[model samples]
Target: MTAREQTEAYEDIPGTWVFDAQRARQGYHLNEFLYSLMKAANRAAFLANEAEYTRRFAMTEAQRTAVLRRDWNKLLELGGVSYALAKLAFTDGKSYQYMASRMTGMTEKEYVEMMLHGGRSPDGWRSRAERQGRA
Candidate 1:
């Protein structure tokens, strides 16, 4: 029926973001704001008054909340690109592992151990379709 509905058929991969057409459109403003932090001046302004800064970028209230909450999963669900989100993470002086740990619901130490042990167990991880007995 729509481009978004078309993607509903295949975007069921577990524990991942696809950055599909729908997501790209949805996250455009958010990703733009994240990417804008590439400049030190912009980053400074953002850190100064986040709410005002978000407003300046025309970011949705949900996006503002996701940023303020540092809710990485919610940000992704709101169409944020992992690569772009990394800029914000770096601005906060966080490591990629830190972001990954947050996304996976693991403490950094536990996540590091899991990585050392060859990453998370795939058990109990399923797509929406699989969970719904569609796949």
Candidate 2:
């Protein structure tokens, strides 16, 4: 079986690991967004036309080579999406919420809610909600 198939198969194995199906699905969706953005004509042209994208987000020569070879996990481990989005926002006036929505199939409002609720991090918004007796 392919690597992806093997990974999928592992999901069915009970007690194999701490599996979060929702998080896995979200990661998959985010990867798809990164792939599409990397290949999009408009985005490519925009990157090409905009000097700052290259100046800020383009990987180093070694990183570029690694990314070109589809080393996705490595790229992510090295701060791929986060780095790229931060650079894009800093140089292009885009917001992380907008970028996160674009990358994760979530709406901007949803992204904001998630951020506010600490859904994106370990310390979730539950505490704040609880403080307000909304939890």
Identify the leading candidate in terms of TM-score.
Answer: 1
Error of 2 at 42 (Å): 20
- Per-residue CA lDDT of model 1 for 2-74, tens digit only, reads 7767577556667777788778899999999999999999989988998888887767899889998899998
Estimate, for each residue in 11-129, the C-alpha lDDT of model 2 and write its tens digit.
Answer: 54332221245434434433333444544563665456543433344345544443444343344433355644344343345676675565556788888888788666423323444
| Decoy 2 TM-score against native | 0.32
Question: So what's the TM-score on candidate 1?
Answer: 0.84
Candidates' C-alpha lDDT: 0.85, 0.47
User: Which portions of model 2 show Cα errors greater than 4 Å?
Assistant: 1-48, 51-81, 118-135
The local lDDT score (0 to 100) that residue 18 gets in candidate 2 is 19
For model 2, the run of ten residues with the poorest summed lDDT: 14-23
Error of 1 at 101 (Å): 0.6
